[model samples]
Target chain A: MEMTVAEALVECLERENVEVVFGYPGGAVLPLYDALYHSTRIRHVLVRHEQGGVHAADGYARVSGKVGVCIATSGPGATNLVTGIANAYMDSVPLVLFTGQVPTIQIGTDAFQEVDITGITLPITKHNCLLKDPSKLAIVVKNAFHIASTGRPGPVLIDIPKDVAQARISFKYPSTVRLRGYKPTYKGHPAKINEIAKLIGKAKRPIIYAGGGVLASNASEELLKFAEAISAPVTNTFMGLAGFPGDHPLFLGMLGLHGTRYANLAITECDLLIGLGARFDDRVVMNITSFAPHATVVHIDIDPAEIGKVIATNVPLVGDVKLILKELLPLIEKVDRSEWLERIKSLKAQYPLSYNRDSGLKPQFIIEQLWNCTKGDAVIVTDVGQHQMWVAQYYHFKKPRTLVSSGGLGCMGFGLPASVGAALAAHPGCKVVLVTGDGSIQMTIQELATMMEQGLSVKIILFNNSALGMVRQLQQYYCQGRHMATHFQFHPDFEILAKAYGIPAYTFRTEEDVIKGLPEVLESPGPAFVNCIIPPEENVLPMVPIGKGISETIECE
Target chain B: MEKHTLSVLVENSPGVLTRVAGLFARRGFNIDSLAVGRTDRDDVSRMTIVVEGDKPLIEQVTKQLHKLIDVIKISNITEDEYVDRELVMIKVAAEPSQRVEIMHIAGIFRARVVDLGSKTMTFECTGNEGKINAFEESLRPYGIKELVRTGKIAMLRGSKFVALSLAQAREAESA
Candidate 1:
């Protein structure tokens, strides 16, 4: 059937089973949006801005385990998606970004609203392409999705020229993408799996350092099985929060700069460190010379480039974490590291995650109350800073994909729109929480209108400290308490903003009022927002200063 | 810090050069010299990047380069360099009196005068980097006016084995 490239794009999306997309349309994308106007099977949510659309897609991808889609016009509209695209890249989220371009003939003429988005997003994306031929549109679409969703998944861009979107083509979307040089390794080597098994057998103190790869690959079950089989403790990276059950006895919580003391202590004492789907990023592995000093490393990641990028591994297994663990499952024998568990318990008993309980509307207490109320079942998205760390520390996660926050990029203003996206894709009536700081929430606060328009039941808990909490903490410790532009002196009354967006708004200032009032707000059927005023002087603790090892972490005063 | 000559294979796509150069800039890797040209297949372009860094730095750079999807393969060719060549074009301050001496120097360096003027002569020379450097130094006394060098291009001497063997080994592994 002869059809316009724009119509073919909708058809191609249908072929890939895409149901909903987030986008903001403009001049270059009018043709595609016209086709979307006629399509009944695909639903398009009009976002307030291009960045909000991309982040909404990211949230959808993270919560639904499906590749998220977003569309934007050329030039500034496309450039607006850069931060969100880079956020997805750093966190390894699967997103397919479609941007409109200038017509074929006027590509280099610097046409109006025509930016080279493909060029702009090159390094930050998994792959990107600019379609020159209308007939090849189907193939490029397939390739974009294939590259985005497979093998250390990340964002990919497809720049469609305005003319190509208007051109006619005999549409047939390819069933599979076959690139000669793009075959990802799925099965790990037998030798390394066996070596890891042997190491598991010999080591009395072993720790499994899990990351986002496990959750992205849906290998959490395998991770649980492996940890159980070996009786090893599991500590996750910030991005890896939901990869392992936070309530399990062997769970050591997060391990990094702001990681729990138990997890850091266990890491320093471990004999065999198993890295599954986790890049030993500088944030996770500070002072590499002394990180896991007593451990022989075993790194298993799908990306070969990440294998030796940081720490050298004794056993390098490059493949899907789920598949690798499946092959290595039977080779394992049960271990009883009672003494190691004792040490972990001692550490946990000695240094528990604590906060100023009597302080005005403590953020940690609020998060703990959230965990108590929701049973750690909500899709909790957070913006960066002290509030994000507080959530990671206080909210005990029990399932994968429960925590949807930017990890590597540490992006602010990611919570509100992401929560809307997560709510839309989640199980009907599933709780989606946006726990954000006062500074971070203002970054994309316009998305609240989108949430109201879409009627998404997104619950937001604004940690209203009126400052960039993380930056202030850094300056307090390193810059001799020189507070600069971190202050939001004229911060908005978020409750009033929520009321303007036609949502229920509440204020929780006292620790008593928050604990008493939050559950009612959470249980409300429609969208609700709570402005929780927290102490501005509070900081996230047990922080290992940059370039310092985990053992050097300092606890609270 | 030592020097490393890295051969990078990349898809001949738009903005690939920017991605490569941007990676270096973002990571603060000081590139000594860089040369890029089409490979045997027009679909692929080859970049020879000369960077000054030690072993760990080179490893990190190589790993980071591999993270770029356009990059097909990268090999550090500094260890097994059989042949290296650099092309230079120089405009020398030459009058009728000094033209013979310039011509003699060109002859000694096996260069050709691609362009000529009454008072200045432009000579093109291609040789190993050391020889090119020596030729440029000799021309300095003759008041070299302007100069341009096409960095360096290097390959193994026998059988083009670097590419052939690498491809074959990858094929064997894939098979």
Candidate 2:
């Protein structure tokens, strides 16, 4: 059937089973929004800001395991999506963003509301398209989703010119995308897999370093089996948090710069480091020469480029982590490494996680309490900064894909919208908990409206310290406590904001109040907000200052 | 430690070179030399990298290269019998007295003097590694101050293999 490019876009989205779209309309996107008005199957949520729209879509994508869709007008609207797009790009979330541009004739004329969004977002997106021809809209839309959701998933942007959206074209959504340049390796070479298995058998003390790919690939079960079979202790990066059960005897807490003492010590002491779906990012490996000092690293990832980028590896397997683990599982023998396990146990006991109980409303304590109440089944999303690191260190996730947070970019204001997405995607009756800081929550506080509009029933626990706690801590350590812009004197009452958004809200100042109020908040029906006022001096511990080795961690004073 | 020719497919985007080179520099991996060019697909480019490392380390390096989002595919093609060539452009200050001698040396290397000014002559040369090295060494004494050399761009001599035709392999898998 002949249809406008804008109408074809909506039809394409419907073909992909997208029920909701998050966006704000403007001059350049008028044609697309006009088409959207006639569509009954797809619901559009108008956001307060373009950033909110992109983040809301990102949240939806993360939770649904589908490409999250967002649309915006040209110029500032497209530029506003940059930060959110970069956030998704860093975290490897699958998002398809649509931005309207001025007509093709006036592209370089700098017409009103015209911006080169594709050029601006080039670095932040996996791939992008600029559709000047109306005929290419359907194919480009289909290709954008395919690129965004496939292999190492990330955001993809499609900029549709205003005139093209108004032009008529025959619509047909392509069932599959065929791009000559983009081919992802999915299966590992059999010989390489066999070599890895042989290395596993020969290694005396092997440590498995799991990353975000474990959860992305849904390889947690296979990872656990491989660890169990080889008697290897598992450690995770921040993005990989919750990929393995923290309570598992063979599992060590997250490792690297801000990782636990036992986890870092284990990586340092192990003779073999088996990396699964984990890139050796600079945050994890402080000194290339010194990281895994005594180990021969066996790196396995779908992306071949990550294998020896940071730390030299002895064995490299390029394929899906789950697939590689499946092949390696049967070839491995189960052996009890009592000595290594004993050393790890002793280390864990000596440096056990601890915090002062004097404060009545401690963020760490509340996170633990929430974990206990939820039994680690609730999907926990966190904002960036001090609270993010604390939640990483304190919260013990017992299941894979339970903890969702910004790891690569450490983007602030990630929790609320992401929580909403998780709630929307949750198995009916599952709860989505958002652990955010006062500063981080305010950055995207407008997402509260999205939660209410969607009726997502997310529980947001805000750690209100009246300061940018992470920056404050950094100032204390590095800047001799100048305190400059870290403190915020005046702030709106979160309860009032929540009420304005038509969601139940509460505030607790004392530890006793938090203990009593947290459970009540979690049990509430629709979207609820709990603002817990924590002490400003609370600092996340076991920090490795930049350029310092993992062993040189500074514990909380 | 053996030298290997690594063929890398990278997205045709800016700063990819910086990312790839920075990765190698940070890891302290010594790269002998490198070459890059546009592939048949405008969106994708090819990079030919030469590095000396152990077999295990080379494998590890290729895997790490794959981790880079800009890098599409990486294959070690050092084992194949291929043709490798480099182009070098050298500008030497010829004192009118040394012009004939410089031309003589250029002729022996099959180099062409692309530009000639009153006091200086620019020679463009293309050859294998040893030939380029010999030409550079002979011109060094003639006041050769500045030189630009394009690193080795290699292709297999026979029509037995082509990386770009992986569509057939993909089709086989789907079938």
Candidate 3:
């Protein structure tokens, strides 16, 4: 059938089972938006800014386990999506982005609102293409989704020229994609799997270290089973939270700079560290020299580059986490590590994840209260800083894909739009909470308009410290009390901002207010916001000092 | 620092070279020299990148290079006894008096005069790094006007091509 490229693009999205797209309209994307307006198969949520659209897509992808879609025009609109695109790339979120460009004749002539977005985002994207031929749009769309969703998924961009969107093409959507250079290795070698199983069989003090790859590959159940069968304790990276159930007996809550003291201790003393889809990033590896001094590491991942990129591995298996665990399951025998279990118990008893109760309006207490109110049933999104660490520490997520935060990029302004996306994508009755800090909320404060416009239900718990809390903590420790630009000279009233957006707003500055205000915000049906005034001096403790090993973890005392 | 010659096979797609080169630039790993050209296959292009790094650093660089989707295969040819060559075409300012001396120097290096102008002479020379350096220096006194070089290209001395994975090469040997 002969149809315009814009129509075919929408049809292509429908064919891919895309249910929603978060986007903003502009001159270049008029035809595409026009097609969207006439279409019934897909719903488009108009966002206030291009960044909000991309971040919403990212959040939706993280929760929905589907390739999220977003649209923006060329030039400034496209440029605004860079941080969100980079965020998705760093965290391995699958998103297909469509950006409109000027006509081909005026491309290099620097037409109005025309920019080389593909060139600018070349390094950050998994793949990108500029649509030159209208007839090839269908195939390009197929390729973009295929590349974005497979083999360490990331964001992909397709820049459509205004004329190509208006051109007519006899369109037939390509059903399959086979590229010469693009084949992801999905199965581990049998011999290597056996070798790793052998290592697992013999170790007395073994630990199963899981990461975001477990969730990405949907191998959390396998991880739980493996950890059970082997009688090994499981610790997760900050990104790896909820990949293994936080409340499981063998679970060691997050291991990194801000990890639980016992988790750090277990890692410091373990004999064999089996890393599942976890990159040993510098944040986790306090010092390269002695990060896991006593351990022989076995790293399993889908991306071959991550296997030996940082710490050396004794057995490196490059494949999907699920397939690898499935292959390694039958060869393993459960060992009785009573002594190791006892040692771990002792470590946990000696050093627990705890905070002072006397501290005024604590962020950790608020996260715990939020967790209590939701009972681990809600999707928790957090902005970076002390609040993020507090969320990771306090929330005992019992399910995978429940704790969605920016771990790799540590991006602020993530929680608000991401929460909006999560709220829209999640099944009805599932509560979405944005646990954001004061500094972080101001970065993309414009996303509030998106929530109000869409009438989406998002409950926000703002940690209003009147400062960039995490950086302040760092300066207090590292720079000898010389505060740079970490403090806010004057903070805006977020509750008033929420009221202006027509969202219900509440503020809590004391225990009495928290008791009264939190339940009202958490239980309300429509979008709601609560600003909690936390003390300024409180910091996330049990911190592994930069450049020191996990053995030297320090507590608040 | 040790010099390592890495042969990378990539798809001949738009902005692919930029992705490959961009990875190096972003990681602060600079290539000593690089040569690129089409291979026997129409869809694939081969790049020979020479970089100086220690074992671990080079491994990181190679691993990062493989992350680019356009890159198909990579082989570090520095491990084997390989044949390496670079070609240089230099246009040297030569008067009639200096022309004979230039030709004499070029002949000793087994270089050929690819082009000649009224007062300039162009010599094409191909050899190992040492030979190319000496040849270029030999004509430097004539005041060279222009110089262009095809950076080093290398191949293993055996029948093995860099495109073959280890398992594939083993299978080929057994067959």
Candidate 4:
């Protein structure tokens, strides 16, 4: 079957079962867009910016369990996707990005819209290719998908030259990919798994520190079973928010810089620390020497490089978490862990995640109200900052892939566009709520038009602090409160901004207003926005300042 | 820190070298010396990297290198019985009076005079790090004008091999 490379590319996408692609077109991608024009299988979403398109694809991948695909044109269009690509890479989201390139003959001549995108993205991407030969397009696409979605998934880029897209080729999607250098270990070493089982059996106070890898490997159920079999309390990393049931007794909320105090205390005192698909990030292990000092660390991750990269591990299991957990679960011997459970209970009671109830229209209260209104069922997405921490603290997620936020990258402008993708990928009638700060939302507010255009059911919860709350908090602690560029001297009315985008908008100045307006806004049809006026002085508490251990968290006074 | 020599087998593809080099630069892993060339297989290339790190750090470097999609296998051959060699060329000023002494020194090291200019003599030498350093030192008193050296290349002793089958077999046995 002879076809143009662009047409073959579309066929390859169909073969991969890609249902949707978020992209912005440009001159360099004209031929590819023409091919997409004739395709009926894959839906093409035109985002307001290339960054939004990539983020939308990221959200789509996280929610759908598929390799998210995004497309951009040459130079500026490709550059616009850089932040989003880095965001996906840091979070280990499986994404395939296609960028248009100048024609092959003009590649190095500094032709219009020609950039060394492959070189620019080399350090960031897991793998990348610049397509010079049209005959290899199908294989490149196949390889890109395989590399992006496989073990320890990350982003991959395929830059197709304009001429190559226009070139004709015989299309044959390879049934099986054979890369001699790219094999991933999917099963754990039996000896190592046995060692982990023995370690779990011997330990008295064991804690399971779960992260995004658990969710990536679809091991949430196994995580629950492993915890129950070992009777270990599970504390989630920021990315691991929905990996365990938030309502479960063993659940210790999130443990990190702004983690729950009980979770942090449990980490400090636990006898054994079982890290499940979780990298002990700096935020999680604030002081490496003091972090889980008495605990014997057993780090189980698919990526071999991550083991012992930061925190030293006593036993390392390098393989799929779900498979390893299944093997280890059978070997687990449930012990009487009432003493540790009792400690956890007391710690939880003593340092509960609380805020001032007397304060009006608090961001944390809004997240809690949204949780109540949605019944802990909505797919909550959030941008980075105070509101992001608030969502992690307040939203009690009961399901996996329900809380989609930028954990590793902490990209500020991620919420609105990502929610657009999440809403589309979510199950029909499932509400996709975006909790964003005023400063963060404005960074990519243009995506609101994209959301309205798609008629997505995303309820926007904008926490209007009129300042960058996280930075201000940091300044108060670290900069002697010399707040410069932290406060937004001129701020827009988000309600009017949302309304201008044709999204039904409301503003709540009081807690009573939120109590009355939030449920109605969430229950209403199509897309809507609610701007809650929050106090600028509010801060995300229980913060473990840098150089301090998790045990040294400062609780809300 | 101790010096560790690693033999890495990678696919011969565009930007694969960049991928390897970029990884080292970004990860802050210090490379003492590096040399890349074609292997017995046309599609595969071998890179001999001499890096400075402690035991745990070397283990980390090997593991991180293995994460690259193009990197097939890596062997830290520092502990193994291996033969290492580096080729160095020195261009030194040789007056009519110093010719005999320079040639005598070259002959002692088994180095050959590859090129002769009007005011300089270039000697090509191949040896281990000790021999190469000695060769440079002996030529230094002769007013050496320029010098170049190929980074270290090494091979395991006797029947030991750094082949794909051997790596796969080891992995299989461990599994």
Candidate 5:
């Protein structure tokens, strides 16, 4: 049927099963927004800023395992999505971003709201296209979603000129994409799978280093079975948190910088480092040469480039990890790794992750309590900084996609906006929690109005430390304790701020207050905020300082 | 670092060259030369990229290039039995006295005198890198006024191929 390109774009989205798109409209995208207005099947979320829209989409994608869609107008609106796009790219989140461009005639004329968005986002996006023809709109949209959600998923951008969006065309959404270059390997080589099975059978101290790809592949069950079969301790990267059950006996918690003491130690001591859907990031693999020095690293990932890009891979299996794990499961001989398991238990006992009880109103305590209140079922979205690390450290995530924080990009203002999307994507009765710091929350604080407007029951846990705790800790250790520009001298009263946004607010100044107020805040019917004041001096402990191996960790401040 | 020639087949789409070039520039992969043109199939374009890097660096480049959506196929033809060519045009300052000597050099190197001027003679040559370099060197003493060269373009010996079918491509990726 014939329709405007904008309407056709909306129709294409509906065909792709996209329920909502987070966006902020502008002059260039007026036609597209108009089309969105006429569509009843798809909901358009009006975010405060373009960045918020993208992040919210990212959060939604992370939780729901679907291609999150976001839209923005030309120039500044497009530019504002850069960071969020990069964040998604780094973390391998599947997102389709539609940006409005100036009319084709005015594209290169430096017209108002004109920008070369496709060129700007080239390095960040997995794939991008500037749709110049009206007829190609459906195909481009189809390609965008296909490329975005496939193996090793990441953000894909489609820049539609204003004229292209307004032009009428016979819309026919392609049922299948035929990209010669975009084929992703899904099945692991049979020989390689056999080799891995043999390695697992022979291994004494085996550890499964799982990352976000495990969750991306939805291979949590396979991972569980494999770990249990081989009796290997599973250490998660920060992105890999919640991929394996946190309460499992074989779970080694998050490993790398700021990881649990035992998790890092296990990586150092393990003989067989089974890297499952995990790229050894610099943050995760602190010193390349010494990292898993005693181990034979078997890397199974979807992206071939990541195999030996950083850490050398002895056995590189390039395919979808879930499928790979499923294939290798039956071939595995159950190994009794009692000695290694006992060693890990002793190590965990020796280096328990503990914070000082002397410190007042601890962020760790709040996260733990939040975990208890939600019964480890909440989708905990967090912003970067000390509070984010605290959640990663303390929150016992028993399920995959439960912890939705910015892992690779570590963007500071990710929590509130991301929680907005997480809340929307989550299953009914599933609580969405936002853990933000005083410094991190203020970056995208306007998102509070968004939460209130949407009436999303996101439980906001603000760890007000009065300073950028992570950087301050770095300054303290690395910069001779000169805490310049890290401390916040004066901040707005968050309780009053929450009230202005028409959300209930609470302040936890003491331990007794947290014991009384935290559960009540979490249990509130609508959106609620709790400003839990913590000491600025506290640091995320057991950090593997820069240039050092994971074994050389700072246990305490 | 060794010079590695990569014959890459990509979709003949707008900005495909930019995607290829931008990748090299941003990833710090040094491109010695890059020649791109439409292939036999109009929908597909072939790019011959001569890059300077070690074995691992070349592998990294190949893997990264393969990730691009427009990139159809990549062959590191450096070690393959392949025929390579580069085109060069040189304008040498040829006085009446130097004309014969320049012509003799050009004739010996199988270079065609494509253009002639009163003060200079333009020689167009196409050959492997070595032949092109030697031809340019022989005319260097005669005061070369201008020189332009097309980057290296390569193809495998007959029967061997780079553009594989879907099934063959999958097999190649797994291999």
Candidate 6:
């Protein structure tokens, strides 16, 4: 049964039910590629860059609910995966990143194609391993997947030295991982669940603050049941968008900096704020002191550290959100709060989501058009900026786990790669649309080759404002319009770049053009780009300035 | 709100402390004291955190800690029969006239004078939280200048509760 470690790795991947692997071969990973050649069970996707590989895996994971796998060579190749890994880490996507390394003999010698990827990725990954022995390959691979997918899932990297990959060993995928230090609490304690139920029962005006965890744990049903059982309205953070149905009677939409007026007002007025699988990131908690001033916070999450990390919680239920909600639902007393529901209804009516449609080629209008063409089912990935916030504000996502955007890190250049990943993961026939800003798309614009090469059916809708929109907006608000690095005057034409990547490109100058171009782009079978030139002065309205209270939102210019 | 001791096992990595501490700080959770150190495994670290909350909230906190990707295991060893100790190093301005009195007070608390200069002396003391608190209090009257204390570290007292060995824990997780 003796075989090379590289062969063992492929075997382990097979055992884990991994059918697709995105990667590029290089000098350091020759043995792995050689081994991959002999394996027919797994299909290897040769991406143009290491970042594309990681992002493809990210998309594959997000849509399939499986750990995405990607591999790369040493040094620069491994470094290239950093941004993508950080993206997965921020959004809590589960991925297993394998990078080749120089032989152990030349590890510290600064040999060609040698890098300490484990050390370099330590900050960004949930955990990582440097494989020195071929015997540990199966165990490490198994453990990597386990760590990557379990409680508060994130990316994990395993650096296999060239020699280890070539070395001979008997391959046996460990039936179970044995890590004394790692044990995720899947079930919530009965007593704590009772306490949460009691808090829900006692509160007059309760709000369920949902976050990405709800989608990550696949707890939408539990959330719906709990929200209904307690008669509470649900408000979502950016990551929490698809966790609850937007069109539901109790849905208050997104909250915080770019949140809807109704959602923010509900947060301000609620007596009980039950945060499920959502960390109160600063963007969501504009002024921590004034946030939910009257609410008794009940924070439910898998990560214990997140309980009191941002906003204080009276009842901190630590465990899987789905499990905790399941427990709480059964213990709760059912009651109808018609009056509270009516008040929220009134608030929703008074402050419905609206944007000025008079502006030429408005980002909101483009998103609305995109939404119309796709019918709200298309997986929407966005880079960080005004366009990202606008999409979060305007897009009405009907399905759970449909909207794939960076919320935690708000990393720019995330849209293109993440969209590629989402497109790859989408159910056959579903389109993946990336609504990106001109500045954010340029960060990883090299991925254009990935789209062409993979022939992924994704629509790249670029909001070409020729500026770092978010930073520009901040400067306008805080620094008296002394636009420093926020301006991008020399930005390249996205349509031209899309053509360079062998993809059809279109440009929309007017609202009629946007309306015409979107349907054509959405209906296309292959990867395409729509460069919509937008006014740089168009600021994202209903913005809660940094450090300001939710009540202090700027509605219009 | 009663204070409870929580022992958390976390993967050894950068910014893990920040993530953990940031969570508590952001949540407005009152942390009485905290300490962290490497465990038997090179890749894993252990943290001892003391916080004031109800029994339900404390259990929830422990569960939440387990949710952190870096966090491996969380146990509320507060109710368990165990021995807990905290180490505190305090630098006191002990003038020539007060040196003997300071040394005498240190002796009463079983504290060792680890360093001494012409005008100051550093005392090293290790004991349960209460003992360290008392030692610090006793030195406060003598013009304490600086103090540093390692949060409590606890070990079970009986054979029944074997500190789940790394292999056993990993096996359970894999299972």
State the DockQ of every prediction.
Answer: 0.26, 0.16, 0.34, 0.44, 0.47, 0.25
Across residues A1-557, which tens digit of lDDT does each residue of candidate 3 receive?
A: 89999999999999999999999899999999999998897989888888889999999999999999999998898999999999999999999999999998889888899999999999789888888988889888988898899988999999999999999999898766756566788989999999999998999899988999999999999999899898999999998998988878898899989988888888888899999999998888879888778999999998988988888999988899999999888999988899998998888888888888795788888877887787788899888888999998888887888877888898898888898888888889998899999999889899898888888889988999899999999999999989899888997778888899998888888777776778778888898889899988888988988888877887967
Residue-pair clashes per candidate: 0, 13, 0, 0, 0, 20
Query: Model 6 over residues A1-557: C-alpha lDDT tens digits?
Result: 78899888888898999988999899889999998999899878777788878877887888788999999999999999998898899889999999999988998899997887877776678878788767778878888999899988999999988888899998777787776657677898888888888877888999999999999999999889888888889999998998888778999889998898889999999999999999999889989999999999888888776778766678878799988887777788976788889999999998887777676878888877777776777788888889988988878887886887777777787778777777777889877888888888887888787777777878888898888888888899899998999887686767777888888999999999977767877887888888889998888878888778996788863
TM-scores for every candidate against the unseen true structure: 0.94, 0.85, 0.96, 0.98, 0.98, 0.83
Stretches of candidate 6 off by over 4 Å are B1-162, B165-175
Model 1, C-alpha of A7: deviation from truth (Å): 1.2
Off by over 4 Å in 2: A545-548, B1-163, B166-175
Tens-digit lDDT track for model 1 on B1-175? 8889988877777777998898999888899999999887667788999999988789888877877766777888887746778999999999989998889999999999999898999999999888899999999998989999997887866765344235522331110
Compared to the true structure, candidate 4 yields what TM-score?
Answer: 0.98
**Local distance difference test, each candidate:** 0.88, 0.83, 0.88, 0.90, 0.91, 0.83
On residues A1-557, what C-alpha lDDT tens digit does candidate 5 reach at each position? Answer: 99999999999999999998999999999999999989999988899999999999999999999999999999999999999999999999999999999999997899998899999999999999899878888778888888899989999999999888999998787776766678899999999999999998899999999999999999999999888988999999899998999989998889888899999999999999999888899999999887989999999999999989997789999999889988998999987899999999999999989898795887788877887787787899999998888888888889989989998999999888999999989998888889999998999999888888887999888999889999999998899999999999899999999999988888898888888888888777888888889988998998988899999999863
lDDT of 2 at A210: 96
- The TM-scores that each candidate's chain B achieves against the reference are 0.90, 0.86, 0.91, 0.93, 0.93, 0.86
The C-alpha stretches of model 1 lying farther than 4 A from their native spots are: B79-81, B160-175
Tens digit of lDDT per residue, candidate 1, span A272-360? 99999999988889889879999999999999878877888888889999999999899998877899889888988998887766557
Q: By TM-score, highest first, what's the ranking?
A: 4, 5, 3, 1, 2, 6
- Candidate 1, chain A: TM-score? 0.99
Candidate 6 lands at a TM-score of: 0.83
The CAPRI classification for model 4 reads as: acceptable
Tens digits of per-residue lDDT for model 2, A1-557: 99999999889999988988889999889999999999999988877788888877877776667888999999999999998999998888889999999989998898988887876776678877678768878777877887788788889898988899999998877777766445778888899888888877778888999998887788989988888888889999998988899878988888887788888888889999999889988888876766888998889887766766667778888788898888888888766687888888998887776778775677888878887789887788888988888888888888876777888888898777777667666778878888899999999888888778776888888899999999998898889999989999999988998899888889988878877888888887877888888999888878778777787777755
